[model samples]
Target: MKTATKINTRLVVFAKAPQAGKAKTRLIPALGAAGAATLARHMLGRTLDIALSAAVGPVELCMSPTPDDAAWLGIAIDSAVQLSDQGQGDLGQRMACAVQRVTQLEPVLLIGTDCPGLTPALLQQAAEQLGAHDVVMLPASDGGYVLLGLKSPCPEIFSAMPWSTAAVAEISLQRMKALGLRVWVGPMQHDIDEPADLDHLPPELMNL
Candidate 1:
């Protein structure tokens, strides 16, 4: 069989400002709201550094409403590309729309800027895997996904599904199966969504 050629993957990082009270609200009790947001800012910075360093193609920073917000929180974003929210709908709709928008021109990888375990090598691996699969998912320990790469746009994965719950990954997989698309599974990782999630975070990060 002929090996598939590499396609330039656009890496889209979804991130938010690390506001003291607005960020990481779930972890506030254990870490204090300011501490929680500080940690969130740290992780977001690390993730962005990795993405910037490891990116093999275009790096798009899909950020919260305004550049000023990211600026105030010290979240370094690529200013060249204008940022936009995933919209008013749930997470799934935003992801579906993002993939659709990018897949129109090139293969795309949409990732959350919260998975500390993610690195350039892993992002590269996700990009390479997309050659063989229509959808590539890096499962998060919280029963969700950290990274999602798409060779072809598929909206069904994001429509009518529970968002921010343990069912996310399963529902996505089921959607892929139903569509008969070849799905690729990357290494299982974790996203910091709750107080319990702190244990898996980097030690230095845990301190904040």
Candidate 2:
């Protein structure tokens, strides 16, 4: 029997507590604040399940707003990193912190809860690809990334980029290319950030 070679990669899932008035705030207009909050909780729960089931190595939950809030969610992970909205500055800062923390132990793959499209197979591919590349980014159709894995902690890629726009992935790709960094691009995934994004999700996800 051939034994599977374990990849020394840290799988980090970034999340936030599904608190009313705080979680899924963008969907409030269409799904009321209370409804949006409920959906956010459901979505996050599902995301955590997927991560826990597929993880091949140490997993980290990088919770925003507060990590303590995620304690009651009952999601099992190797570690949890609390993030303060402070000094986050923007999405870049938060992402950088996640990578830095995990890269201290091993290669890190950081993903968010928005991508219901993420699967265990894809994550494994990313980890394997990292063996030959400096970075691996799974671009989203909306111009962001669903997953980003790195062999080394590179803050430049995450900082000073225009976030929450279609150019995010494009700009990051350009930066990586310019720096002569060997990058691997994975299959694109859809992120559930806006109302239109809801259409791309499974029926059960939208109902939740």
Candidate 3:
């Protein structure tokens, strides 16, 4: 199927509203529920800032609980950000839904508010990659991916599969290969999902 001609890279940043006990639950063990939520809020803001600064295309924040939810009350999202609800599903299902929805508008670079290493330069690089390749992804040190850029909706890659295990990235690569999709895997980066991952936090986040 012919994909939409790439316009601006439709950047989608996925975030769970940083509510205590709901966001960053794994880190709650070390930082406590409040502290973990504080950290989550910081990370979400930082990710949005980075995404907007990239200026690669229109920035959309696909928030869970929808933008109208009280869970998002007082969270200062930028005016320039277009908001959308992630609706319902597991990680893979929500992601597949987002990809399917946006790829029709333009090629999308879907990222989560996790990787501090996902810089504007890297996002631009991935945007460029999506122009020529079928798929581009920034691998996470944990077995998953930090960013997924696609020129078309390839749900098979995001379908029923392990979401959190280290095998996630490899399995995705295998799935893409089976479908004969071109894939660009960027350098691996750390995701602050566990307490030990806090050690990888950059200086800006060290204060947490």
Candidate 4:
């Protein structure tokens, strides 16, 4: 079978509505419920900005609780960025669905809104790496991953895994290896998920 060349790439941002007591719940102890949700909103906007700045290709915001949720209202998302509902499932299942749906059009680089270290340049590098490798991953300091890019569909990488755990990246990589996929590991980045991780957050966001 002939493999399709990756000519165009899309950045899929998986985010949840910034609802208090539900968004950024891990940080609630240190920042309070409202504060955590406020920070979540900030991170979401920052992530969107990074994706748009990369300008590699179309950017899609895969939202949870549906796009019509009140939490998404008043946010100034660019008209060019498409918004889609993340259908029901666990984290792994939702991600697998997104990758399969978006890759039908072109290659997709999936990311989340929790990682402040995800920059436009880093996204561009991942896109470039995907042109040659079967997969590209940006590892998080917490042992999870901040970004994953694929030139083709690979659902096995996102199935039956422990979500929100330190073993996420390791398990995912092992799955990729078992499937004989070439993977490019990117720089180690940290995501804001706990009180300890607050130190890594931007000063402006820290105030929230």
TM-score of each: 0.90, 0.86, 0.95, 0.94
Q: Clashing residue pairs, candidate 4? A: none
Off by over 4 Å in 4: 1-7
Query: Candidate 1, residues 1-208: lDDT per residue as tens digits?
Result: 5344466888888877788888889989999988988887888778777877775578877766555554455555555444565555667777788888889899998988778899899888888878877888899988899999997778888888877889989988988999999888988998888888887888777565
State the local distance difference test value for candidate 2: 0.76
lDDT-best of 1 and 2:
1
Clashes (candidate 2): 0
Q: lDDT tens digits, residues 82-148, model 4?
A: 9999999899899889889888888899999999988898998888888888899999999999999
Task: Give all candidates' CA lDDT scores.
Answer: 0.80, 0.76, 0.89, 0.89
Q: Which stretches of candidate 1 lie over 4 Å from their true place?
A: 1-5, 68-74, 78-82
Winner by TM-score: 3
TM-score of 3: 0.95
Worst 10 residues of 2 by lDDT: 78-87
Minimum summed lDDT over a 10-residue window in model 4 is located at 1-10
Ranking of models by TM-score: 3, 4, 1, 2
Pairs with backbone N, CA or C atoms under 3 Å apart (clashes), candidate 1: none
Task: Mark the regions of model 2 whose C-alpha exceeds 4 Å error after superposition.
Answer: 1-6, 69-87
Per-residue error (Å), model 2, residue 49: 1.4
User: Per-residue alpha-carbon lDDT of model 3 for 8-101, expressed as tens digits?
Assistant: 8989999999999999999999999999999999999999998999888999999889889899998999999999999898988998999999
